[model samples]
Target: MRTVLVLTVSLLLFSCSPDTDDERIGISGDSFLIFGHFFGECIGEGCVETFKLTESQLLEDTIDDYSGQQLNFEVLSDALYQQVRDLPDFFPLELLNEKEAVIGCPDCADGGGLFIVYSKNGTQQSWRIDQSKGNVPVYLHDFIDQVNARIALINQ
Candidate 1:
């Protein structure tokens, strides 16, 4: 009887313990999205604007370079963050499965370019999209518009 009680208690304790599997924990983790626009020939602080959006906060990249390769971020004000917090939800899932990381000639002619990085379920994908509507896939036009609109909103 004592052995049975001990076994039952041990089983209960193990069952109640939090899961420690990294894969399982990662599955429930919040996804992250990073997006921004850059103009190689532009001047001014707004020339290269980028942002990182998480499940709870919006962060603006402090780096002012035209490349999105490296970025550092600072949290934006709650009011401003709220305005673009839903931006991640608008990311098209099809882009994740795309074979091309770059859709068109971004910033090839002094035209601005859009940059995007999406992370979910332990997978990450990024893209460099042309600012010219005709230069990008038709499906991405709406998302580009949304991105431009949000950029304007924050800059305002």
Candidate 2:
């Protein structure tokens, strides 16, 4: 009886643990997930526009139904906490207006965030937003939430 109970508890815990974060916020066909807020605003010519993403900002992208183990996490976060784990790191992120986080980090894709390397049948290669998002933990979370909301709208 004791062995059976312990096995059952262990199985439950393991099953609940997230191998990757692909369902927290906005989710698409690709195995991408977000978990925070997002806001974008700008002034073009004489017009001003603003957008905010809150509770509904969670987003997801699951490419070909691939998942955490298949994508591999250790390569990106370098044993960092779950908060920044398994993000892609594309080479010349600078061209995309990003920075190289560590030496010999190669490209962020296959590691950190989606690097477009894992593209679906006909998906766009990248996210081409205009604004820069500093690596503020709080801000990232909020942005994810806001993006999730947008994804939700698109689904409807």
Candidate 3:
């Protein structure tokens, strides 16, 4: 009897979930929404680059990594991001520095996105780059290597 009641309730609840499209909280002030988890889809005008967000687990997986804080959309930061984007969980942040990090948003309004800040120890940085243009995420290790390579290329 209990099982039947549980099933009935579960069915009712799932049936009630809105059937338009699954929505994602966009980076800048919630104007854009991702309806699905597209492993290689390009968004925003600034980046024609495709994203592999399987690791961020933006869809689910509690215990946000970077900060080990309760995950919430409006308040998520690099602390939580480390968790959200941990390898195999999702994709790790795409940018890093010696003591800081800047997680990029591929697409944002007007080709201007934002950055999530973090320290070298992987703690979330209080400062964030909001709605910046030209800066973008491109996978952490690759981004760092390229930056160094660019300097070398210039020297040569």
Q: Of models 1 and 3, which has the larger lDDT?
A: 1
TM-score of each: 0.78, 0.20, 0.20
Please list the residue runs of candidate 2 whose C-alpha ends up more than 4 Å from where it truly belongs after superposition.
1-96, 100-136
Error of 2 at 90 (Å): 22
Q: Judged by TM-score relative to the true structure, which candidate is superior, 1 or 2?
A: 1
Candidates in order have lDDT scores of 0.80, 0.30, 0.31
Ranking by TM-score: 1, 3, 2
Error of 3 at 22 (Å): 36
Model 3 alpha-carbon drift over 4 Å, by segment: 1-56, 60-95, 98-109, 117-122, 126-156
Model 1 / residue 142 / CA error / Å: 0.4
Question: In terms of TM-score, which candidate is strongest?
Answer: 1
How would you encode candidate 2's per-residue C-alpha lDDT over 44-83 as one tens digit per residue? 3212111211122322322212212222111222222232
What total of clashing residue pairs does each candidate reach? 0, 42, 12
Tell me how far the alpha carbon of residue 39 in candidate 3 is from the true structure, in angstroms, after superposition: 22
